[model samples]
Target: MSGRKFAMKKTKSRRKKWASSQLFYEYSTFFRKNADNVIFQVTSDQLPTLNRIGLDDLFMSKGHIREPHWHPNAAELDYVVTGEVVIGMVDPIRHHLLQFHVTPSQVVFIPINWWHWITAVSDDVHVVQVFSSAKRQIIEGSNVLRKTPPKVFQQSYDVNAKQFASLVSPIKETVVIGPPDRYALTNLSDEHPESVPRVVNHTPPGSPNLFFDLKRNLAVRRDHSYLYEVTSTQIPMMNVLSLGDLYLTMGHVREPHWHPNADELDYVISGEVTVSILDPNTLAVCNYRLKPGQVTLIPKGWLHWIIPYTEDAHMLVYFNDGKIESVEGSDILRLTPADVFQRAYDIHAREFTREISSITGTLMIGPPDRPRR
Candidate 1:
């Protein structure tokens, strides 16, 4: 009776925990909207299972800019999903300004505490920014420019206090998407060229390469599925964030695996997919069916796999570690001695060995095609 009661208690506890675990979120319903620009965010606040990883879906129109800002606690990996943008950042080590023109399927890395900004170069631009922290803290340039007293500017730079005050007066609030709608525009020629910081189009030697083209670098290509990845190996500038662009068709599976060092957030771009995760604590398997604009989070070291339900499923997987180290399920089954399996489960050793002989390597995507008898 005691054993039966303990089993029932455990089952009840598992049900309670599963009921509270949130593995799916919709981006379309939860977003911060600006006039012509918008941002959708996913952090620990929204998904309790998230660990040291977050994402922001940002959209901007031509000539608009995502105001200059610096994240105090996170490194950012920006992946361009559509259109083009110019990413500008100030290198603190060299005190140089660097700019890169990024188009669709490209990426730019911004180190933690680096001042950076983005300007849309095309009509419709969508960039997904992945952060290393669950809750990324930001300090906007508008706050710095508006909050500082004009007298301090005059004292430091020897500028007219009244003129400086007038110039910044229009910035009443945090202008996330700039040129504030009420602000007037004026074209003025550069009168003090020497004062302007020289902008460089290319990175200096010995400096981290900040730009990479994901489409050009295909990590894996199969008949029905393909993946593109970006990590510290590809761009040393990537501090603690990495990305994988994945596309899988119906009947295709992202083979079961576990990341030993990094947490994962999967964001669906098109079609539908089902993500399965096995919780180590409760020994329960949870399955989440996600559609376009939906997302799921998998904690570090958790066993998981993805299967597509539609013909053209696309998703982006983000990780908190720049170098993702994973252990594939196929490797474990194929490498384990048949005798060990027999000893553990009382199975026929020879049959187990023969059954797994076909799995000679890491099968990232499975069911190897075999001729039907």
Candidate 2:
């Protein structure tokens, strides 16, 4: 049975339908109407299968900052889509500060429970932060400091209660994103000149900027189809997710494959494509026809494939792991003994051998045949 029908039959009117629409938040409009810097999230609450993966869209204008925050339940993997930003984080375990100047195509990872914040460097900045959970868990710095009571801070730091109270008075509310006012004295650049981010590579010895430039890290292709990935192999600091940008020409396919340990979420960036995912658990199949801005989540260990519906389609895929481990469908089908196929399906041995003999290697992306009209 198809995944859609199975979901309905199993629930039997107890639950509403599983989400079918692609997650397409109008980020530009959301940010413009909101008072502060914008953040839109998509999680299991929005789509059930999204329980294993979540995404947050962040947008900020010049001088604005995303307040320092930490996720207790998920690690954050941020990808810069446009403009520039400086990310600063406090490593509680290491007892040090880590910062990075991130630009388009660059990525950064914040380990779980680490306090981190981002400030836009350009006129406008757009970032996509992916989390390894259905819902993002966050604790803002302002809330932590403000709610602790001035007396507690005074005792802990051996400071005067009156002085500490005055110091923390500005933290009136949880500033999800700041500055409290356009001309506020608490602006990051004005008050924290020493922490200003420089463009130069300032990767500390142990904590490096997990940045990967796609222009430099090219994945060779047989035809026009190509795939470029950033995993732990490329950046040791990456601990949460592996990112990939894939391009496929019309009439080609990103061959069937399954990740051994990661769930894959894809954001279609250009053109159109059709994706098929087969669930091994229930032996059910689901298909999604996607266009730009649409996203699809393939559960972990599910067999899946992608075929382009237009010329030069592009997709950004995120895996919930630092390294990608995949088992290609071609490898499974071609490696089995030829007689196994004949015995299982009652196929003639000669025909089975001939069919299996032609597959030379694991084809990651396509046989390059034209699609039927």
The lDDT for every candidate, in the order shown, is 0.78, 0.72
Q: Candidate 2: RMSD over Cα atoms?
A: 7.0
Clashing pairs in 2: none
**Each candidate's root-mean-square deviation in Å?**
8.8, 7.0
TM-score of 2: 0.79
Q: Best TM-score goes to which candidate?
A: 1
Error of 1 at 100 (Å): 1.2
* Model 1 error, position 327 (Å): 0.8
Please list the residue runs of candidate 1 whose C-alpha ends up more than 4 Å from where it truly belongs after superposition: 1-20, 28-36, 183-201, 369-373
The CA lDDT at 106 in model 2 is 79
User: How do the residues 1-373 of candidate 1 rate in per-residue lDDT, one tens digit apiece?
Assistant: 2211211121111112474357666553233335347776787788767778888878776666788999999989998877788899988988878888888778899999999999876766778888888888989999999999999999999999999989888888888777677533222114433322334458876567898889877877667788899999999768588889999988779999999998889987767788898988777788887765567888889899999989988889998888878898888898888899999999999988877777767777765555222
- Residues forming the 10-long window of minimal summed lDDT in candidate 1: 6-15
Clashes of 2: 0
Off by over 4 Å in 2: 1-36, 158-170, 182-196, 214-222, 237-240, 281-284, 352-358, 368-373
